[model samples]
Target: MPPQPSRRTFLQLTGVSAASVALGVSAPASADATPARPIPDGAFALGVASGDPRPDGFVLWTRLAPTPLATDGHGGMPSADVPVQYEVAEDSGFRRVVRRGLAIATPDLAHAVHPEVRGLQPGREYFYRFRVGNQLSPTGRTKTLPATGDSFSFATASCQAWYHGYFPAHRDIARRTPDAVFFLGDYIYEYGINAGDNLWREGVTVGPEHAVEIETLEQYRLRYGLFKSDPDLQAAHAAAPWFLVWDDHEVQNNYGAANSLYGVPPELFVHRRAVAYRAYYENLPFALDSLPDGPDGRIYRRYDVGSLARVHLLDTRQYRDPLPVDEADRLSEQRTIMGAEQERWLYDGLRGSRTPWNLVAGGVVLTAITDDRTEQWDGYPANRRRVLEAMGDAGTAVMLTGDIHRHVASELKLDFADPASRTVGVELVCSSIGSNGDGVDTDQYAKDWLQHPYVKLYNARRGYVHTTLTRSELTAEFVTFPYIQADANAQPNVVARFRTPAVDPRLEAL
Candidate 1:
């Protein structure tokens, strides 16, 4: 990589003419030619991505990480702000540039930039790239949602641990080229590397640098950098815009609100959560509205995919009560997974939505299970009932979930124990990207889950759920990979498939 430039040198070299002018930035000269100085070798090593698609446009993101795994967590960038230029073109070749802008990659935010691009045509595919002097970031393709439409395709994935295995599932997701990806959390694991309790993959171990649990801001930032360094993950991000929600592993296992699983005091856990939340915002393609306010960030929101589907992206971890330890506690009416405010918001959205399909995207499973899985909706019975009742006879609802590390297709019922209760919707739980290493086809755990008739399918594997939503019906394919621990060339296979007709909410095997 080229030597780090001085603050003055960077400003002088990047703050030049036409591009700055287009973005309304006052600069010295026209930037029609390359910089007089040498460009850095890996300035855009982390790659480019876009997300949160609107009818007009979406957010474009990139970080200047020439040295991605630096210990200081600055991505090997200088302390000064770097002016990065971006362009949106109708073609990948940039021959028909439409929008050009400049954004400052600030050091305080770990040299990341999120430019809220707007005024583009709806339902149109656009190619975007970032530039710093003569250096160019990887080109990324993103599309804006249409104002009205009949069909849309999206994939749901979650629980990608860097130490667990290779990200063959992400590569497969890129190849599928979905319109959007719903990443339902555990985006990063918080456990210390090589802890011996969890051995990641067979014969493969985590590096020494990550051998300690991440607690501080720098540590968390570095952890995210390490995961983002994976080329497969980068390819997926580059392929389609992502809608993300973080589960427990983003901070610590089974952490609820300010409560820690290790019995850490609430006061201290809040500080840790603050750091994790800030780092999460800095790394992902979230808009400024999702920026962290101390330990809290507004992640629960809604997206309209034309007239086809209404996606409610929820945050179930930030304001929920801790997991119940006993049956009495689990059945408590006061116990909540989605806090009161979020619950109201979701209920109101479901009651008033006019879209053909109502899709609720969440971090944990919503379907009723036979086991006492208090960490999931099984523990928050009252809240789950409220949601089901809110959906009432709407019958158009579907829940997309992750975090169980297994693929499941289940019926959402007012009561799982009683077959006479009304069925409100269907829940599709996607398997992990690569969390539990190479999973088996059928395990004792899978058979154990089959005790509940609501669970139509259960598979222990590493992959994602691909779904196609149309005006007539919704089809879901449980895409899985045989191995991920060592097989980079692993291909995804459809282990099972199901479909739900427009007015019928039952998940029937296809």
Candidate 2:
């Protein structure tokens, strides 16, 4: 007879099973030294990271993985002060140190810190690292935007399920070495997918022997740590500072504030959201103002890419009412995705912005696609129309979106049905980094939809979008990998290239 599973073994089997499924391995023995390591009693684990950099500053983040590395949120690590030192320099070496400071990693925030490093030269490349006593975390390199009027390049990506596939795209993004990376959402999936079973029999296994059920702060931390364990993600963070936002999987599926589509109870959803938000704030390099408070939280903020672009990061999840099932049209307008305040904030930013390109860093697709039952902009038609109208009137705007899980370059027309109206702005939708769904295919139905003059390039491929912007023009390219699970040395295929005039918004193939 097979040996009976112990309580510890049972917990490991279910809680992290999805992670194991991703790795394509059976649950390994607990005695494996490769999966477990011991840091010095006072040492911080999980290394360090930086995010959301402006011309003058960036947010640095790190956490103290609980002493025993508990997965159930009950490690009982007390609130303690961990002194963290941050350094920035022009050279990778310390010879020409420009900025240095100390900040306390407070227990109130699970021993995480986000030190906003300021007073640095703009548009120049710099290196930074965090230190605790003699132990040094990974050194990260970043660049601040040149003063407004300077032209530069940036990249955006989303939907990186660590277990779903490899992150060779990060390696590719690293090679291009853009000024910054915009991470839209789905940073982590909360559910446990089949590990090396059914569709993914060849995937490599990682952790949580079974599906994840807990939504506590500790659970979220473990998930983030698992993703950070990927060297590609680590290298991506090290390559450049990132502007980020979250989508459903970070908390639960199709979560809309008071509830989620997966049938989580209202109060239970609130608790899970609280835990997820707190964990997200702790793990990410966000400003202190974006911190969460138990259930109700704020993550919507904006980043200025100097005079080249003004990025307005909006929170589409936090304020949304529960999704409507049958009466989609009523909820389309009655339901508030960004709520009143955030919508107003976005509108104000777009209307008042003077940047050549107004990049709206949104979590969901802004353009409407047919038959997409998921919570896309189509489900919120009124909201979509309002946003498109705003972009049309604003004159210079571009929509960058995730949640579609496929690469598409579409012309934002006055209407999808009516092909005659002058195109308002160019909307570029990027495919997932590693999602469960297939890539966007240019099928007959897809081509039929693109019949509208505004609809330009439609592709179904697993890859990322690269946007190169300058004072003269803006170009968007859908860089596709040969396969989602390809090895580290995979090359990206430029499946389709679309460009638009910065003065007038129109999609044209290069």
Candidate 3:
């Protein structure tokens, strides 16, 4: 059995798993690590990825899967270790190889390899690939954060439900190939998937294990295999280094810490989170340092875009308080979404940041809509209050969030009820990548956001937000897709664009 997550404070990370006590641990190769047979056919069927960028290095990842949808959920591999070779080059072609090394793919991690590449020049483009026996994986492109720069552009994406629709939004993201990608949450839905033909996902077959909700370690590994097989998603992963943070759907919907929405005992739910978190680490291009120890993982961290900007990736699901049941509960000082320690860390970082732009990326919105306050920050008004006031002092802060399946661009206020309250920052809510099927321009929930003065625009569509920040101002483009299920190949269009100047938290039509 894999390590499970704990609902206790982040400091409780040391008791169970050895990885919990340290920053990172390498997968050990036992004496029986060598494969008993020759490498299988079509070994690299699941594609490759690179992420968690740094000044000198990035993490490279790939998994061996001859039968990607095997019922046993081991990617059809024997219980042994495989030697996977990796190559990094200055050009797309492997002719100018810069670095080469070997990584051990262990059965404990479903034959996945996460080799951290280092000693590379900053602000320079590089291409990488993996090789196993006679097979070679697709080439992936990424760059390191510069030691100094004047501008940076990145894309924010979230909520990709395979059964909901095709991934044209992901295809578009691959085409743009932003500086880096911030994937907020819902990488894969935990619900059971149907093998029928009428679903939005056409022409794909799922294994029998997918007919029910996933719970075990192998089940979660198989679920990731199904989602990672998409070519468009693979392209997006290969396009740039991605930074990821999970929301409810990664384990279960509407779960707060270990408090299951359907009333499962906390002790039992932790078992499910153990496998889910382990599978999440095995599939994504996450560095070994942030590997989950049971149900507790450290993902809330910061990234500095040289001298241009600063980015903060928040983890809300792992350490949040239980949902409030009434008005007084919502207003209680004890209520919090970011946990106490993370909140203090965020405020301290904001106060000490010297960059012109401070970007905060989380899974939920800070802006309050008239309806639906249970899961988002509106449910915990006390935490929301501190974040609002802190951003107001940060001078040039922007909030990037996703969860609601609608694109919302709003100006945030300290006191939303008062007409003359101070403007703290701007919130750009990115819509789903392929969730909720083909969305619409307006729906019943649309009115709840439109009547608010702070909301500048609301479009119910499936797409992402493209942002560019420079010394003078930050520009935003809300990209949307016309139809996802009906026309999987449809080209995307920019529905709205806005700009906010440095040190001034106000949006102007671009």
Candidate 4:
């Protein structure tokens, strides 16, 4: 066995050490840092991805997985770390190279690399790719936002389940190729994959061993490997930079800082959650600074699209309290959806922004789902009030959300009980990419959401929401499709479109 590491070194290795501590340990320099000759076949199976875009640069991602489905969860890589080379160019043809760098693919991280490339032109398109020895990965396209601009566009998506059918939404989003994609959680479900689950993809069978719920690090890594292997999902990742966050399904069904809904002890579940988070960090192209230490990690962040809009991403799951069970608990001022520090970060970040448009993006629907207020913002009214106050303190605001598997466009109010409550912002609840089968055009059960006068449209279907922002106004199209189960190349139809002026809190039908 390898020598046991010291407590300080272990803490540093797991990223639990002090923020000032340098995590890297230097080794002797070599002429060629990475392997240049021996071939690792199909190392880029899960495909390349890029996200967390900025004015100067963005993050690039890839994994060396010659055998992606290896039960060991290391993606069939060498026990030693591998150095991967990356290239960024102004053109897809690679005639004008811009910036280049090397990122280490470590075994502990499932052989993945999240390289944050900087010092590029702002608001311009760039092409990037990865190379391990002579094997080059599939080329991906990404762009940086302008420091100040007149217009910007982006797509919002969430809740894609591998068991549910196919990703026509991702396929469509790739075709649209927005400036950036806000992926608001549930990227991969923790549920097991069975051979009978998706017969749509004939000859595709998951081992019976995978039919159990994923709770271990290996299970979570294998789950992501199966999900990321989708070609449609891969195309969407390659299409544009994605600003990503997570919801409950990323870990378990309805878990928080408290004991799980499944009744697992918090002491035990935290270990499972830690490994789940580590797997999540390794799979996606999020910033490395948000790395998890034990059960603690930071996913709440802010992004800007020039001077036109500022997007505030929240972590509604990590610090959220358990689902309220009684009236007092439901209305308790002590209750919180975004825990203290995250709440403070969110409020200050939103209130202090100078951009004309400020957006709050999160996993759960910001508005009330119905009379019940358990898992969503409604469960923590005081927290919602404070967030609304922040939104009102800032100028015109829009809250983008996912996870209810339905689309909703409504006006957010500080007081849901008072009919005269002033509308402070606009809320858009996007449907899942493909979580609940092919879905439908309308559902009678979803009508309760439309009971509120402020609520404009509610639809139960499978697709995403596309929005475009100008200096004066923002237009959103509620795109849905009737069939993804029957056909993989299903087309999208915009059932509802709304336009709201930068100064208006109302969602006007288009």
Worst 10 residues of 1 by lDDT: 18-27
Q: What is the TM-score of each candidate against the true structure?
A: 0.91, 0.85, 0.93, 0.93
Q: Show where candidate 3 strays beyond 4 Å.
A: 1-36, 195-198
> Please, what is the whole-model Cα lDDT of each candidate in the order they appear?
0.82, 0.69, 0.82, 0.81
The residue ranges of model 4 lying beyond 4 angstroms of the native Cα positions read 1-33, 36-39, 195-203
Residue clash pairs of candidate 1 = none
Error of 2 at 416 (Å): 3.2
lDDT of 2 at 448: 44
On a 0 to 100 scale, what is the lDDT of residue 365 in model 2?
A: 77
What are the per-residue Cα lDDT tens digits for candidate 3 across 118-144? Answer: 899888788999877777888999988
Candidate 1 deviates by what RMSD?
A: 6.7
Which scores higher on lDDT, 3 or 4?
A: 3
Better of 1 and 3 by TM-score: 3
| Clashing pairs counted in every model | 0, 21, 6, 0
Between prediction 1 and prediction 2, the one with superior TM-score is 1
What would the TM-score be for candidate 2 when compared with the true structure? 0.85
Q: In angstroms, how far off is 201's CA in candidate 2? A: 9.0
Alpha-carbon lDDT of model 3? 0.82
Q: In terms of TM-score, how similar is model 1 to the real structure?
A: 0.91
Q: lDDT tens digits, residues 261-320, model 1? A: 899888777767877887887888888778666676799999888888888998999888
Worst 10 residues of 2 by lDDT: 18-27
- Model 4 lDDT per residue over 264-345, tens place: 8776777767778878988998777777765667889888878888889999998888888898988899899899999899
